[model samples]
Target: MHTTPHPPTITTVAVPPGSAIASALPGAYFADSYETTDPDPATSALQAWLSTVAQVPGWTNRLMALRNRLVRLAGLKDLGALGGDAAHPLRDAASYRVGDRVGIFRIRHLADDEVVMGQDDRHLDVQVSLTKRQPPEGPPRVALSTVVHVHNTLGRVYMALVVPFHRRIVRTLLARYAAR
Candidate 1:
């Protein structure tokens, strides 16, 4: 494996319950780290989408809060490398093959916004859509709403799966860390 830029450390900011803007674009953070370079194409698209969110006033804090939660759950240390490999748990989880099912559920939605993927009782739900127009050409675009939910399996629970799936997808599609 080739060594890449160091992953940005996950910053634990003290966001008051109702202080900052929710859904505040991830671009600010990404720009701060990469000087707005957005190495991954998906991230570039995300930055554009966030720009739309930034236009809204009150929604900022709400969106920021949600983004914070999603980022935390993703197990991603850096928003800079949204597509680059940094140790994703969800992708590995979805790719797991045991017996018949791996206790993961996924759903994919095209022509919509938000790529929703999660592990239900025994399936992975993945949804992909296009809410806003994506950047001209960058990484695979995914909605910021994309997420991975975990479920309890019959005494065979792998919680790490949810975390990594979200991380991989975010860094890959939404953030474009994995974009060529």
Candidate 2:
């Protein structure tokens, strides 16, 4: 009898307490992380994940397309198209200096094991960080986390609408990484 292999697991982790991205916005109204065992260098792994995620197909693409339309109608900046002539969808650490634009986000900080990106609009400021850590056992772990601070009622409402989809996408991306 033939059987299919079980998919790798993806875990939702608490955002690291002292992460640089966590510091970007005190009292972040929303924050969460998804992690997987990935032995590759953090930056490279994250870059690859971003590239792959950007090419999302099927229902995910449909959702994102709807999001793009809604955000545009709301006068919010959409994450511009990624990975055409560029090597990766988001700017790489080697090419991005602080303040450089990467899609809808801006490069806030970069390190060998982590990269922090942020976007600020009238409603809120959002920060995302990808970090790599080596635990005592097993393969290295990579975590993707985001922190958002709402400025007003609109910010709160916007976050409420996006958080669910955000979690789904993050988990899906982590699962993809684990599968690789």
Candidate 3:
């Protein structure tokens, strides 16, 4: 008999004390994380799944639209979309290198156990990490973390406005399945 595999469920968890992701961005103004138990190839599976969530949700797009209009008024570049330019430099996560772009983040470090990516703009510097921890005899746990460091008043204001939606977005993205 043939059967389909069950998908993993993501959950919000307290940041592991002194986790690398939290320290990735110095003087970070915001940080959060989510976790799921995955199997072998956890890092790759998580990477594949993250590629699908770059654009975020429709409601988020609407909010981005409003943000674009307002930020433009303040002479900030209109960050066209959440996904960034994945079509050119980064078509997929299957063949990404340490310097490649993954959605809006640039890969700072990559490995079988973890990936560290971030972007530094005039407003802020943000870092993200996806890690897989395999135990001796249990399902592997995958954790995704984000840290943002504000560079100025504008950055602080921008983060303040988006913090609420950011958590929800992260949860929504993680609730889905990782690639098989």
Clash number by candidate, in order: 42, 0, 0
User: Candidate 2 residues 81-157, lDDT tens each?
Assistant: 42222422454446666787665567687766676878888888888887777778888888888988888998999
Tens digit per residue, CA lDDT, model 3, 1-180? 999866567777755444556566456688888887654453463364465355366886677678779988988766555555435334656677778766556778776667778778789888877777765786777677888888899999989888898787776655543433
Model 2: lDDT to the true structure? 0.70
Rank candidates by TM-score, best first. Answer: 2, 3, 1
Residue pairs whose backbone atoms clash in candidate 3: none
Between prediction 1 and prediction 3, which has the larger lDDT? 3
Model 3 CA lDDT for position 40: 42
Model 2 bad stretches (over 4 Å):
1-3, 42-55, 81-93
List the global CA lDDT of all models: 0.29, 0.70, 0.68
- What TM-score does each of the candidates earn? 0.25, 0.82, 0.74
- Superposed by TM-score, candidate 1 places the C-alpha of residue 122 at a distance from the truth, in angstroms, of 1.4
lDDT of 1 at 83: 20
